[model samples]
Target: MHREIGPLRALANGVFCLGLLGLAGFGAVQVAGKNWQVQDTYHLSAAFDSISGLEPGGRVFVQGVDAGVVEAIVPPSTPGDPVRLTLRIDARLRPLIRTDAEARIVTQGVVGARVVEIRPGSAEAEILPDGGVIASEKPLELADLMQKASAALERLDTVAGSAEEGLAEVNAIASAIRGGEGTLGRLLTDDEPVNRLVQLTDRGEQTLADIQDNLDALKNTWPISRYFTRRGYDDRDLALYRPNASRKSMTISESDLFDPGRAVLTKAGREQLNSVAEWTKEHLTKKTEVVIASFTDNSLDDLMAERLTQQQAEAIREYLVDNHGIDSAGWFRSRTVAAVGFGRHRPRMISAEPQGTSPDRRVEIILFTPQAAS
Candidate 1:
């Protein structure tokens, strides 16, 4: 205005401020498309038992998508129940339906447009509320799945006519095992035990090729060639009764029954007398020890400086042979000494000095034995 300011009037005031910044960016996308089409609403009801093709503007689904609409069907003020509908939906899916939400009335394809879905239930429940109702869903349509597939094809045609009469009694037992009659029709008409098993497999392959040509002529003959030389002086003495319990298949009585001072035993002295008769039949029950006298200490440092015990020295050798009478009953002798040991541990002292220990040492009996338990 301070005069000319020309340049085509400053390019028409910069095209009117670029058309007011494209009309304020087309009025801010038309006020953000009416504030993103303002959704947030709720309502939901349902009931139904037969809302015959649900109406009031229909479309309210949830899992099948749509999400809102059917605002009112009516007739459910409770008389004989069922018919409610209501819906309105979309409050951002009122926290996904719940309080046992169910709804139904579905349809849409066999002629489309029936709607009302809803579904979504257990989010640990409690969301429902704004008009609540729900609970309807019986579904299973396609004319009730073709009347349950025509009663499961009439129980699979009565189990395929009892498996075609059990396959016509297994085709009359395979035509009685192919006409012969049974036992596979006498083994398919036996040929005298199939020609006696083909003449016993050809006389057992000619008696196994004549016993391999008589063991290849007894491997070139003689004891079959001195069977280990002159049958070792012919069972010397019948191999001392048991050289392979020989009845004379000898070798000088199996070499004087393995002599090493041969009175005959030597199979390593009959396996060391059968391991000493299996350790004398595992120690055939012998137990008697009972002597135990101690404290007169023949030094193991005076039997551990006197801790003598073998049942307190056999209760002081039966109190010195029955109450101090000491006749050394059969030379009584007991001694178990080990003053200190260490490796297999030691310190087990028990004394008896003729059962002494009372004098004022505070009650000390000490006789313990009962541990023989192997």
Candidate 2:
């Protein structure tokens, strides 16, 4: 074989050797790129609830740019404490890292290696110290997601079973009705039950009308007429009464009067109302009318907020009229008290506070006096 020693064979052999060298150089460059060591780097740390897949030597990115490497991972000394990670970042990027910067563990791509992503804080934020701990967002774990999905599926199964049972019961009831086996079934099958129900409804309505008529006659009677007039029990509607001017106003926080998410007043609420009662007694005049309005900021829907505020206003009015014996009738022989709920609408600014940050959950009591005689 050595006797030939042709030029073509020698040329082919040289080409193969050069190709091998080129491949080796390419591999070395790749390995070095993966494990590049930063020079004059500074250390920062972060604590996470869970760092399921990240490990030391993992890349750290700042705002999606390759910035550094994770130096080490330290397990908590106590069982329930978070896992801490130390990061070694290039000194060049130190100014960009801020005190409010956040670190989160994220996968590079689907099924790819995990890396730490740092979201740089705003420019106005103070620079983070070299060794300061950056705030960490808990990593989303595939296992936890699977567990939640399984739980949701189980709940769906339970709901399906309940629906099946309910449908079966409904079918049975329908069958019974068709066969005229029970009271409801008989009512459906016969006409007498329907007629009886109609008669009963008519009788109830007639009874209510008679009661109202007798009450009206009693109000006009001589002995009780004076008391009824003083109480403002007349044909005039309170809805028509309107105030010409507001003389004074007092505002109280909703928390001071009612418990959270309820219209019912507490003992402290009663005490607070007692103070309002005293204030009213001192300032109330024959020509003045009282109006209580409530507002709320927490409700997502306007209608619900309105209902809640209305109930709260009613509760306050009830306390003032029944408990404190505050007169609700004016000298003009008309109702002088009104309660309204504005909900989140027409919000009052408290102490020059901005609307966005103002305390919207509050009750306002205003005294309306007739326009001064010109």
Candidate 3:
């Protein structure tokens, strides 16, 4: 081994050794470069319920293009808090990343390393600032899916068993009926049961008719008759007709249109009525009816209060019909004008003031329009 060698042979061996060292150095540089922070990059973060296999140094993609890398993963201080991921992204993508952009953990190809995938938000959204957190979609876990599938199968099995039991019970009942072994079976087999059922139905119809007749007669009787008249139930046409549910209304305070304790409209009240007439002319249709409801805040007895409010409501109706030429006849020749009085018994309004405050005496003019026929 110590024997002298040729110079040419020695020089060739030295060259081969140098080549091997260079190759090793090149590989070392390549390995370190994977974790190196590239220049001209910006930082961003996202929160996820679970990162699962995603880790630091993972690549980040935007719409299938390589755009950045995951710089760090911060575990939550609390057990239930989300896992946070810091990302180092190319500065060129800064304008494309929006506040609404969503991030998710995904794998590249089958059996490849996990990476972060960002879905760029709509152009109308504001751009996300550096170091800002982006929205994250929870990563789907294979284990969780499997557990849910197993639970679904268990429920299906239970349902199938119950269905089988129900089928057996149904078959047993069918067999009993076929054998004429129960009351239902007997009723199906005999004609007397059918005849008896028909007779019972006839009797029930007669009883209902008698009850209806009694109610009609009661509606026409003494004290009750007055109540029905006030409610507009005395008119058979109005009682049977169903109006459309939608309506428009205008309210004016009693003091605005009338003097205290008087149902007569003041001069200002006439002006207010003229304005209401203009509004009604714009919105009124042939199928629409007018309703005038008046309320009073006076301390008069119920009878006197009723009379006063009635007079007030009638006055407004008369002025609209006589002065503005509003029609009194509505759809199908029915009386479209309805005037009602609630003396000291004000119905609730949509724009009512707070409770514990006494409301002003007011008048409400409402237009009830029928729905268009199909």
Q: Which stretches of candidate 2 lie over 4 Å from their true place?
A: 1-26, 38-42, 75-82, 90-96, 108-112, 177-185, 188-374
Taking the tens digit of each residue's C-alpha lDDT, what string does model 1 give over 1-374? Answer: 47778899899999999999999998988764443334677676767667666677767777666777776677867677777767777777688788887777767765576776777887688888787777887753556655654555565455556555545655665676678764855655877645755655565565556555555444334324334222221222221222121111101111222232122334553444344334333322222112221122233343342343222323322332343333222222322111111111122331322233322111111222223435
Candidate number that wins on lDDT, 2 or 3: 2
Q: Candidate 3 overall Cα lDDT vs. reference?
A: 0.74
Model 3: how far is 74 from its true place, Å? 2.7
lDDT of candidate 2 over 269-296, digit per residue (tens)? 9999999999987877777777777888
lDDT of each: 0.48, 0.75, 0.74
Clashes of 2: 0
Model 2 TM: 0.40
Q: Rank candidates by TM-score, best first.
A: 2, 3, 1
List TM-score per model, in order: 0.21, 0.40, 0.39
Q: Is candidate 1 or candidate 3 better by TM-score?
A: 3
Tell me how far candidate 1 lies from the true structure as C-alpha RMSD in angstroms.
43.9
Whichever of 1 and 3 has more lDDT, that candidate is: 3
Q: Highest lDDT: give the candidate number.
A: 2
